[model samples]
Target chain A: MSSPLLEIKGLKKYFLRQQAFWQKWTGKKEYIYAVDGVSFSVNKGETVGLVGESGCGKSTLGRTILRLYEPTAGEIYFDGEKINDLRGDELLQLRRRMQIIFQDPFASLNPRQTVEKIIGLPLKIQGMKGRELSERIDELLEQVGLARVHRKRFPHQFSGGQRQRVGIARALAVNPSFVVADEPVSALDVSIQAQIINLLQELQEKMGLTYLFIAHDLSVVSYVSDRIVVMYLGQVMEMGPAEEIFSSPQHPYTKALLSSIPRIGKKNPSTGRIILEGSVPSPLNPPAGCKFNTRCFIKNKPAACFHEPPPLIEGAPGHYAACHLLG
Target chain B: MAELLKIKDLQVHFFTDYGVVKAVDGIDLTLQEGEALGILGESGCGKSMTALAVMGLVPFPGRITGGEIIFAGRDLCRLTEKEMRRIRGKEIAMIFQDPLTTLNPVLKVGEQITEAIRLHHEEGDLSPASGRRGFFRFWEDRRRREMAAWKKAVEMMEKVGIPSPELRMEEYPHQFSGGMRQRAMIAIALSCNPRLLIADELTTALDVTIQAQILDLMRRIKEDFRTSILFISHDLGAISELCDRAAVMYAGKIVETGSVQEITGAPFHPYTQGILASIPRLGEKEYRIKPIPGNVPDLGDLPAGCSFFPRCPYGQAKCKTELPPLEEAGEGRQVRCFYWRQIRAQREEEGGIGGELSFAGD
Candidate 1:
């Protein structure tokens, strides 16, 4: 589809654990496999939903893609150009096209800074100043549906929804082409979350922006995303069109995640929830084979699950799943 | 089937510098014995404050100035500080959203649980074992009672599905996982065999699988202990799952109260309906979001009439001047709305929200 806007191939970001004295003496080592071998492509003018449990590396992946955290391995091609090798001024120039919106609007925002300075800081950093920067700040604030009067007020003075709107304004300040919204609506209340989601959707349409929407919540991701990626521990479980993934999920983990969502009223007959027995395994020492095999609802799994890691292969036309059982 | 806790016209105000923040303004609530009542609301709705008022633990600068909290046969509001302390965690217990913070990091998990048990010991509990209860058996009874409480703490841990209760009991709150910590907290709350358990978003911090586990555990706790739960949460799904009846709160007032079915199914208050519509369901694709128009009004300086009128889609000129009273909408349903009857009639005619929102994508 027009040679995708962002293509990540076998991306891996691992952090070594601070070893104990004895471990260091004996040369024992371990790695927190936060984002391991993740691959996906986001086309221009599209939103790809990344769904996983808290420690499933969705945030890490999002951060690593934007070079907020450098990847230990693999390639990143943004706008059909190799970006993993970019340095200093070159990287800064590339970063002008990428931005991230954090989860906690309260924590992400500088408490002491006024909304105007917060929005203007990004523009000022990008060499824009004087009347143009102030005007651009006003436009950004208006674009995110915030009042002009709010620009002078501090972040703490605004409500959660308003603060989130401010966060959006800051993200759009530099006019980034690619945005990573990491659980943007998670910290907000339902009604507030809806407003933020609608704002993001509208902004995406108007600006022709591409978003890598990262969230633990499937419902939220589904609401605004065109494509959905399901991950467990640190590996992709299933990736497909939003409709296909929700309507007819292939991977067991995806099914479990979908069912675990507490919908109002009766449990749907379409997919009975399979509540996994154990909690997510530690990322530092993930399971040997398939990351999800330990908690996979599929019973009597073959030994291959514990031995061989499944490759992400297309199950349907555009749906990809990493499961040995799928052929 | 008698009412365990009855709160009538309860007004809790935070005496802030800005103004008297009416956190819980004139809330009328009733919870039956063994019934789980879910208080659903956004952050500033004062649901947590109501629970705190029930426990007589409203934080500093906030006081319950008016209203009656009738628990058992007596008015709880009339209780002295010393008397209220006896009922705080004994007859009524609460678990906060964050178990990590709610739990004492310095103390062992079991110690805290045992402390709750020993402090709120039933007078008759130790008497049976120590026969001939005269001047003598005081020291003997104390030792025996202490031993019983220790065992009870472990028993509670086991009951809430904490594995290796004996070992986990010795560990501090930080030692346990997120799910285990919540279970431990639940155990401590249930240790006193509290008749009314007030859980304020206990499962919010947990993951979905663990949330399911915790919710299932709470359901079991209610079934086994017949503990009347005043469950407060922002998650409607969790509310729908655990609550028999739910009250939707908005800016220090309950907009609607009904059975779980009515709250989720045929909600009269536009806020309740809007709340249900806002959360995207898992089963459906293209989650048609119909966000309420504006933010909840500044509680410090609320509007002339309805607090929700500023955001409500169905708000009219009449709503702007007159605050709607909480009136009986139908059987076992109370709604604070001026146009509920007409809305219900319109729903019957137009199938949903009078064509405003048509259960889009359902």
Candidate 2:
């Protein structure tokens, strides 16, 4: 297999939480453990889908991979070069090769700027000007299936789907080999979402690009990803090929999550659904041992699940799950 | 089942500066008592507007130009604001997509639920305006009723499966999580035991797991209360799970209406078919996502012919020139397409019927 284009090792991100008056007086420091210890890799021209619920640190992990959020600890290697020690111009060059697409098309795009300027800013930053930059902007618009007439339109004039197309155009203007699409289609309507997904796939094949697609929707992620990484709280609960994980998810958390997805015509829900009892615990005070133990629906769960943290153990070839019950 | 809520040719139009945007342009829907009816549509399709129109809560500048919202044997549109207010929450309650914003942030969760109870169920001689009494005696009577309403609120919280109801009741809306806030919203809506409950994308903002919990709660509530639900959503999965019958809306029109099984299993309308095909299926062998080309039609300036003509794959010359009436397709099924029969036949000839519409029909 070719070397992975981007690899993350034992990544961790902790944000300092604002303390109460008593805690402040006591000089107690508190940290919100966002992306605790997530590790994954994306091969060249392949998509690695990072799936998790909200507050599960999936977005934080994506930002940390792109170095948008400085990691508290761990290493991120792009093209086999460690990116942690890079600074100044080196970091700027790293950013040029790695781009990110945000979830909200409305908030991501500047309301005042025209589509031309929005897509042209990145190319202009790369020193392309005048006709060269304008041509690139038009080309990028057409590539993302937008009309050239929309070039002069503001963000407010366009629809949600159209604004997302503009966002995609801007992301590709840098010609980045790797893109972190953080819930790119989540904000779009269902039909519009499919269009964007197809657009992302087409762009990937045409440009031979790699992706760290971060989304909460498992069905959408499974369709686009070659490999899937499931995160809970701030840890990887399971990782496997898309098909294997979808068909036979090993971890209790993965099973419950997959089963929770309400399919269209699937009747006799009692036999299929494993409705988890409670919501995900606060990440700051995540449960001891298995992070999923609080909501795991497995009957007579092992005592070790509550006391001992399970390491990611390979079940099937390439399929790894972190759960005491798996043992 | 008895007819609980009926909307006939509802026309909710916004008289904006640009033009009259027909938000709900001549749509008809009926919800049977104890039945769950889902309205599946895209963002600008006016599904939510229909719910708001029924509740007499259509925002400013938007007026019900022409329509009759008959609820519990009374024309809601003809009723006065005071009369409508009595029916709004007591007989027909609606929960919105975002509970956090819909809920009053200043009040305690329990107090909000208690307000709903107190509004609909007032005790005799307890209200301050009931009669002239000593000030302290009137205050004492009011306190007694308020405490009774608070007790009912605790029961409502327990019914919605909220833990530590007494403690959580005193907490503010911001103190609750997204799922819990939604549960609190449901508690407030169900406090008065309404006959018809309208849920507008209730689970759209929730996580999948949390969505499952909310859906399950709704199902249980439907059974326990026998409350007819008019569920409006853009998600087919959630609609299929919660609704017994569904109506597919496009550009403020009901393009298709049928049972949930038929809508998901053997849809005839091209828009319904397109929506079904667009969603990525998990267990399917092949990825058969065929996105309907083109954006949703602009609500302000819709085509005279079929509203879905722009994006519909089976559109013909006649569809572009003249509108098609919502005609009966099968038993208890309606389709507003001129070429639905031909389109279904064409797909069947290609053997796409059995292979496609992969909603996990096993």
Candidate 3:
């Protein structure tokens, strides 16, 4: 395989929770295990889909990869360089090669700023200004399928899809090699979502961009990503080729999640609905041993499931699932 | 089968200073006994209004200005506020999109269910413990009724698959997770065992796994209770699994209505066709998700003719000036397009049933 463009090793993001008065007296330590010990690599010109339910730290992992959030502890290597130790001007230089697309279009762009300024800001910050910068901003707007008429208009003036187009334009302004698209289409309408998805695909092929696409929707991820990484609580439950994970999922959680997707035209729900017994346990107090043991559906679940955290073992070629039942 | 509810020429208008916002314009629908009908539409397409209008709870500045909402031979439109209140919970129960906002945050989830139970009992006209003759009056004999209601509430909590109902009943809405809160909302709505349940995007706020659980729970509820569900959602996939029939709405109008099988299989209307095409399906190839060109029309100032004509792929010259009345296409399916037949015929010739809809790529 060609060299991996972006790599994360044992990423651990923990947020300390303030103790209540009683808890403080009792001397309790609290930390929200957002992204706990996650390791993955994204190959050049390929999309690595990071799938998880909300609060599973999919967003946090993406943000941390982009250095938006200070890593609690981990190493992030981008384009064969260890970026964990980079700071000041070095970090800013690194940022030029990595860009992020946010979920909410309503909040991501400044309401007061015009589309021109919004898209031009990145280039301007990098010292490109005047006519040269203006032409590039116009080019980006066209690239993302937004009209030049919207150049003078603020974010509020455009529709949700248009605002997202503006967001894409801004992200691409820096000519970033890797993009972390964090639920880019989640907020838009279904029809409009396809437009953005298609646009992303077109842009990817054209620019030869690499993506770490993070989204809760598996169908969307499957459509875009080459590889799929499924997260539960704060750990990677399954990682493999997108098709393999979707078709022959090894993890019980992946099975449940995939089966849970309501099919479009199937008249009498052919597959058995795997309704998990309860919600995902709070990450702060995640269950011991296997994170999924509490709601596992394996008929002959072993005693080891409750007592031992399963390592991400190879289930198939390039496929890994963290489940004791496999053993 | 008895017609449970029928809405005829129903028009809901918001008389704003900017102009009359025609939210729901001349909609006609009929729901048979034990039928789950989905009102599928994009945001602001008046699907919620159709649900809220049935429940007689359309927010202020908006009023049901025209037509009849006849339920069980009683005209809901003609019913007084007092009469509507009696029918609201006892006969028809509705749940909003956001469970947290609709539910009472401070009250225990169990208390909410019990309150729904209590309201039905207190207002039940056919109960043997009559107000005129019973020795135990409502205020005087509150404890006896509450005890019964409490038991029923726990039963409801358990029915919706909330484990340990006894323990969960005491907990507030905030204590419950997102899925749990939605389940609590469902428990409250189903507690009274109403004839019809109006679920307005009930699973929209939930996670996919939780949504699947709730859908399964609803499916079970339908079979067990034989309750008719008016399921409203923007998700075709979720609704297709649950709804027996579906009404595709656009710009406050029902463009098409048909059996869920027919609707998902061969959608007659262009908007429905576009929507189904837009969604990125599992195992579907990248070529399938072609976004319908143009935006949904503004309800405040809809076009002179068809609201969707601007974005519709099959639009013709006639669609520019005259609004096509919703007519029966075939086999109980309705379509509002002026050129559906021609479009289908041409599409067939092209041999592209699942083909792209010619997205006027920007």
Candidate 4:
């Protein structure tokens, strides 16, 4: 296989809590392990879907890879270059090659900015000007299935789906090879979701764009992704091709998640569903070893699952799972 | 089986500045005792509006223009506000989508639950308020009843699968997580053991895993209490799993109604077929999701004929000229489409509606 367009290795991001007067004096601090030790790679023109429940650090991982949140440790290599060590103008230049699409199109776009300005801001920031920027903005809008006449309209004038198209147009303005789409279609209606997914797929084929699609909807991920990575409580649980992961999920957590998806047919009487008991454990104090050990339903769950973190082992060719069962 | 609730020709409309919106034009549904009826539709299809109309909880600018909501052999529409209030929590209850919005923020969870119980008891004639005029007498009786109801509320909370109900009861709404808050809402809704429960998109805001758990809990509760349910949701997969009978609503009309097996296995209506086709299933190598084309019609400016005519793939001249009444299409199946029979025959010839019937693998 060719080298991945974007590669993340042992990426970790922790936020330190603001210290109160007493805590400051005592030198005590707490940290939120939002994205800890998450590693994945997206090859050129491949869509890698990151699936997890809310608060499982999927969004944080997406943001960290795009450098929206600076990584606290580890490294990110884009096009075979270590991007974490870059600084100032060099880092800004590198950002032009990668882009991000936020979850809420309403909140992400500036209400005061017109559609032209919103889509042209990236080109303007990259030092394009005058006729070149205007022409590029129009092209981007057409590419995302929006009309150039909408360029003068403000964000409030557009519908939810239209606003998302504007966001996608802005993301493509810079001609980035890799994009981090965090729940891009979750906020849209079902019919609109299919439109956006089709648009993204079409755009990928047209531009050879690689996408790191992050969402909680398993069905959406299964449809869009070439490979899928399942995360739980800030750690990777399973990684494999989308077909393999959905058809024969080896990890217990993946199996539970797949079963949880409601399917339209006669109810299966014998396939026992694994209803994950208890809420996701707090990220600040995640359990040692397998973060999913508390919810694992396997009989004879190994004692090592609580004390020793299992490494990602190859369960099959091109499939990996981090569980003591695999070990 | 005795019918617990029967709604006929329900018409709910909102008087907006733009125009009079026919949100629920004409809907008919029935719920038998201990039966779970699922209302399946996309957003703006009037599924939730039907639920609110049944519960008499339509918001401002909206009203149940015409309908009969007969619950427990009583015409609820004819009842006075005072009489309806008495029956709301004692004989029928509703669980909303967002639990926090339904719950009081300032009050402790215990107080909120006990308040429901106290109101139910007062309505049931089980508690007679003292006529004494002093402030102390009122205060004393209120405290005594609250204290007694708190214990019963804790028991109800425990029965709904809440852990350490006694301890959690004293906590505020913010202390409970999303799933836990929903459980508490369910506990409060079922505290009086109402004969019918109306869940309006209760699991929409929850995660898939939590949604499955909630659906299972509702199923278990129905079997144990022998209560009927009006479960409304947009997820066909979820409704198929939890509901024995399913109704597909569109533009305030139930376009299709049938047993879950028939609805999911061999959907008759164009809208139902479109929805089933759009859903992504497990082990399906073909990932192309054929989404239903076009948007739902704006209620204020509905088309001259069928509301779905603009989007239906098989729409014809007849569909654009006259509205189709929901008619019996087959055994245990009803459809509201001008060309449903023709479409079904064509679908069978073309290999059964995008291979969904084959997916079931009979």
Q: Write the per-residue lDDT of candidate 2 for residues A202-245, one digit (tens) a residue.
A: 99999998998999988899889989999999999999999899
TM-scores for all predictions? 0.95, 0.97, 0.95, 0.94
Number of clashing residue pairs in every model? 0, 0, 0, 0
- State what share of the real interface contacts each candidate retains: 0.50, 0.73, 0.71, 0.50
- Order of candidate numbers by DockQ, starting with the best: 2, 4, 3, 1
The B-chain TM-score of model 1 reads 0.93
Interface RMSD after interface superposition, each candidate: 3.3, 1.5, 6.3, 2.6
Per-residue lDDT of model 4, residues A215-327, tens digit only: 98898898899999999888899999998998888899998998877766755622577788878888878888889988787888878999998889998988999988877
As for lDDT, the candidate ahead, 2 or 3, is 2
lDDT of 3 at A297: 76
- TM-scores of chain A across the candidates, in order, are 0.96, 0.97, 0.97, 0.97
| Residue A204 displacement in candidate 1 (angstroms) | 0.7
- Tell me the tens digit of each residue's lDDT in model 1 across A209-272: 9999998877787777889999888889999999899889899888777777776765331235
Candidate 3 regions exceeding 4 Å error are A21-26, B123-140, B354-362
Candidate 4, pairs of clashing residues:
none
User: Residues B288-348, candidate 2, lDDT per residue (tens digit)?
Assistant: 6888888998899999899888887777899998999999987889999898889889988
Q: Which 10 consecutive positions of candidate 4 chain A have the poorest summed lDDT? A: A263-272
Off by over 4 Å in 1: A19-26, A267-271, B122-146, B353-362
Candidate 3 lDDT over residue span B1-362, tens digit each: 89999999999999999999999999999999899999999888999998889999989899999999999899999889999999998889998889888888888888888888888776342133434445657664465567778888898888888889999999988899999888888888888789999999988878888888889989998889999999999988889889899999999999999988778777778888788778876854445687999788889899999989999887889889999999889877899988888777876787655333321110
Best-performing candidate as measured by DockQ = 2
Best by TM-score: 2
